[model samples]
Target: LVQTWKDDSSIFAHDGRLNTPYSDHLLGSKYCIHAKGFEVNTARVGDSLYYGCVPVILADQYDLPFMDILNWRAFSVVVTASDIPNLKKILQEISPQEYSVLQANVLKVRRHFQWH
Candidate 1:
């Protein structure tokens, strides 16, 4: 994937050449990819919400925080790890109207993901 997006100007690929501030990237993007690391649990999801970026979580069998209280589907896009190859298609299939609702819900649920 790194090689595939290396020359793509649209992607921030983050190969050390993209030295912009992390907050800048988060705030500027509409959707943040929260791909799982070695551990299933990561701070990316919360971080995305904090910056008002809708999270595109690509983790299988991973439980998101506050699942019982928060309807994650309303604010974020949850895709299985197996669907990584089709990620672009999946995201594109989301209508603009649906994206707006998701983004609006991200703002509505932002307070819940914060420490304060």
Candidate 2:
């Protein structure tokens, strides 16, 4: 699957969902939150969480609720504006143990985020 954040413009003046291009674009890239401005909660976030691709969020604000219930710190890796290059390096060097833990963390949050 492939998905372009669709809102990564330099000026940052868009208001919409950043659908990761087609799923094919996501084949190996994992997941991303490359939207321009604010970041509350996005479908891509849920999709990546649900899909276990380890979301790479690019939003300035990671304002998510239920932090106590869901373990973003445990499962996913994040890169701030200055840390993108390091983030890429981390992606390339991720250990199997880390990957497995991330997957497990996703499952841990599954029941809480699932549709009723």
Candidate 3:
């Protein structure tokens, strides 16, 4: 999938190490991919929120940190494992106007993800 979407400007799909620092990349990007690692939850989501980047969460059964108080759908894109192949298409379908709303909401809820 990375190979197929490498040239697609809207999608920053890369396989290996990024030339730019990871934190810098997060600050510049509009969306950050938060795939589940060994655990069902990871700090990737929080990191994305901290940097004001909307999260693209790829988890089948994640109990998002603040599901009760925050509307995850407002600021993040939750993609199922079944839709991995169509990830790019799903993200692309989110118009720039909608993305702006998502990013704005990310800032609004970022404090919830902070330690202090």
TM-score against native, each model:
0.86, 0.62, 0.83
What is the C-alpha lDDT profile of model 1 across 61-113, one tens digit per residue? 76778889989899989989789888778888999999999999999988877
Off by over 4 Å in 2: 1-36
Give the distance in Å from residue 91's predicted Cα in candidate 2 to where it truly belongs: 1.2
| Every candidate's lDDT | 0.81, 0.57, 0.86
Q: Tell me the alpha-carbon RMSD of every candidate.
A: 2.0, 6.5, 2.1
lDDT preference between candidates 2 and 3, better one: 3
For model 3, what is the C-alpha lDDT against the true structure?
0.86
Model 3: lowest-lDDT 10 consecutive positions:
35-44
Model 2 scores what on Cα lDDT? 0.57
Q: Which stretches of candidate 3 lie over 4 Å from their true place?
A: 1-10, 14-19
Model 1 steric clash pairs: none
For model 3, give the RMSD to the true fold. 2.1
